[model samples]
Target: MDKSYDPFKYSSDSLEDVAEQISDVLKCPITIEDVNHRLLAYSTHSDSTDPARISTIIGRRVPEKVIHSLWKDGTIPALLKSQEPIHVKNIKEVGLGNRVAISIWKNNEVLGFIWAQEINKSLTSNELDLLKKAANAVQNKLLYLQKGKMKKEEREQEFFWKLLTGNTLRHDDMADGFYQLNKTMPPIYSVVLFRFTKPITEKMEKQLNYLLETTQLVHICLVTIDYNELILLVSPKEEQPLNQIKQFLRVMEKQMMQRYNIEHFAMSIGGIYSDISSVHIAYKEALAVLKVKERYLSDAEHLMSFSELGIYQYLDVLAEKRKHNRSPNYPLSQLEKYDNEHHSNLIETLETFIDSDSNVKTAAKQLNVHVNTLNYRLKRIQEITGLDLKNVNEKFSILLEIKIRNMGL
Candidate 1:
């Protein structure tokens, strides 16, 4: 805002001031590099541990090779060319932790760029929002200084998003882009999109990335959403057995609960769908399953495969009462005769008494008889079946037989 102010000095110094404030607030390493690709200023926390000091990096062009490789890959080019800040993943070459890059300029002159590396921690919602606001503010400051250099960058960034989301090109161009994307992946892979009810924190995101890295278990593409959900694209080389995956999921669930201190985030695992494009539908199915939890809460995490839910059958009927009837192959008239001759309300009463676990009072109340009368009926039941109603095994078998015989009749 000062007229005699060096725009570079102002932005870099201002960035350092803001970074320090942010570092104090968030306790993260915040570093700002100038337009010349030199480190102008960094947070005190970063300076303490970083061997490369800002003085050494100031006024030097960042290595051509570093930006060149990224440009060739079209990642950095998209951001730098567009004049817009971008959030990038898998930028391991830049350094450990997640990186956010923003180009800086003022009065149509390129001021430089700022890079913030989230060290040892994932970006929190409030932190990310603050960073985004900070980045845009810095960009606007540059635009105020170097007016009229912003239009191209905006268009380029929009193009990048459309391309990334597969909304930019014709069907053929889309296929080609997908082909290039898949060239880095295994030939036969499966994509599973797991959705959660809560937003994944930076720590959980890093933990998930670490798990995938260590196990070499699944090639995962994680996209965090505003709705506090993760769109995970898991491409496993060669189909993994369901059991092994289930075990891993169980372990992950336990770790998430213990480490993050959150629970009841239902994961709806989609069926293994081959090819990348099918991944979108897989996400839909996973979402459907999560939505249907009311119907399947009894199973909990055990019900991963939605196709196995048999939802229709369940919705149409309650549990079938065990039919204690003879097989259809047996004579119908025989069953009728058995029922006619077995007019022994005594046996029926005994069966009911035993099924009630020999609780004479309960059986008596159920049968509208006295406890002594129910006990006498039970004694006669032991005489007929040669099984003690008092024993659990005997009681279970007798109850089962009674159910079967009832069904037969």
Candidate 2:
């Protein structure tokens, strides 16, 4: 091959022809992949090759472990940042051989990658320079593909808004829209939301997209951005979408913190559903969870789904109804009034006793007092309020009232 001749000087109709041309020039195997590591094309090679490339060619996507290894080893971060050809050392654990790769880029965004596997010798400095030129040429090749993707994203965003707003006419249309844009209507999915401390910038949005595209934990069907909210329609990559959603949240959180030192964000999800029409409900539930977190920031910090809210789900209604009442229904007023006069913890004792389900020993342990002393406090509480500790209904009502007061209702 003449060093003066550019392998990618002329245009090809498809990436496969380009890959073959690169392989023929460099005297090594070549593979082409999209930004997400989905195999777009690979050249026919009879030379020594690694299992990772073989698996990727067969599966049509890079295996999860190889992607993980690249991320962990800083190979992916280098590829994302640099335009020059990168030399990656062999990683035997994932069956990844030595390779020279370069990111195909447009306007500072990576469009795809071209990898040249080293079968025998290392890529010469000239070969690396040639690889960079090929990446530049491939950028032009990918321009048409990228424009098509951007147009498709515009359409998907419109349909996502319709799904969330319940503006669509029927489930069939919803399924058809999903099939058209995202390839398949997911069997099960959940609405997940992440609210940042501030409005997301274009740069942050790009980072989020990179993170989402690179993750294999969830099948992200649709994504849209509000002022500060990153909304997603996601289904499981493995099984049981609920747990998968939580796992994805954790991954996103870790990535954001590691990459950008981003700390101010909260994530939540709605109940998983099979029907595409129920996206509106899921979106609402996810919003409700975020609202609940804002109100009860400490208590609901670990709340992942609306169903997990349990009794807190309806607390607003109960609080509202109590707002109009003229008198306290479970008036612990006597206990309150007695504690104020004597400077005793009688109200605390009473609340603890109720919380413990009238279990004297448990309440005593919680209050850091002896069982006999707790019995004495219980006696005093019953005497002061004329309360019967044995009545289950009364105790339950008192607990509910206590919650309402604690919430400042």
Candidate 3:
């Protein structure tokens, strides 16, 4: 059983404190309104230090003009009702100057709104990011405070676990959790895992975000690992028909390769799974499919599932690999040296043979190389590396070595 949260508790006070901080950073005035559109609290840059200005609006109803302006326009109110954050660019129509307003919500429940006025100038990317972070923090603080008031941690956890087990929806509780977590996540979602022909970069981070936003799938949660891979949690509503998640990933791959000038970015997508806990499983499957994608895809787009490959049993290993900083063992220098120096076609040969399960005939046919030439190169590989193909352990090591090499490690 959960205890009810007290409105007069310190948690609510802490939320107000956070809201004040957000108002300061965004350089805008804030008016936190209740569901009835009554002003619960208000803070302004000019009088934030003055407790009187903050208290003046406590019992007052929000101005009719502000309500009309926010709701009459439809977008912000709709976003508030939907519990999704809304960013309005040209908010000057309401006498607030050009601005971006982020609605604060909990479980699709409209708690209040935060208006970040772009009065002085256009917000730089960094500033915008900072504003977003601050706003989200305020929202998170409020959510925890609200939950504290309801004494609902046990109920929330039970509901969340049930959501995962499919025993119940408890959508109200689940939505509350999602709303709180969203503040700490990316604005768009995709189920993408990164592989390093090279380590991750800020450019990759920004690019991933851009892809989600441009795709118009807002409410994304991105988990980044140290090795430059990312896992995206995307909203289904933004997903397009005929544009499967795989295709969307492919488009991202193409853009990263061609437009961003990143030639070797590898992305694998597990087919979409709607349940929240299944996200981890989906990401693992995507990583597994990605390991094979490089050799087989040959292009920007490739989608495969571990189950489809009958490698579902190895899903745990794949999941471990998806963790950041676990680079493929073969160094990029060695792979490049082999690819660039040996007309031996050693790099392609290794990738293809491993992908084809060390089948000489199949590897040769796929590479369009004579069987004799393939065998000769395999001999050279043994001579150079002191490894025998007939040895199962050595074969596994060699296959992994080849993967490391091709990953440009």
Best by TM-score: 2
Query: Candidate 3 lDDT, tens digit per residue, 1-409?
Result: 1223222233234645655765665566655543435444555555222232233264265443444455546654465454434555443444334545555665545545554545455656555555545454556655655566345534434443443344544545445666664333222233556576777776565545444534432333433344666555544444452145556656666656654577766666564555454544555667667766654454213344444545323433544564554653443335446657764466667668766788999999999989999998778666655666677776765555554433433
Q: What is the TM-score of each candidate against the true structure?
A: 0.35, 0.87, 0.33
Q: lDDT-based ranking, best first?
A: 2, 3, 1
Candidate with better lDDT, 1 vs 2: 2
Residue-level lDDT tens digits of model 1 in 1-409? 2333222233433656766755565566666554434454566754433222232344233443344345545655465455555665544454333556666555444465666555666666665555545554566544443344345434433433443354643645534544544434323322233455667776556555433433334544333333455545455546554444555567567655654455766665665655545544555566666655544454333566556554322331322332232243222233334447876575467566765667788879989988887777667555654665567875665454444454332
lDDT of each: 0.51, 0.85, 0.53
How much lDDT does candidate 1 score?
0.51
Query: Number of clashing pairs, model 2?
Result: 0
Ranking by TM-score: 2, 1, 3
**Candidate 2, 35: how far from true, in Å?**
2.7
The reply for model 1, stretches above 4 Å from the true place, is 1-175, 179-215, 239-241, 299-301, 312-409
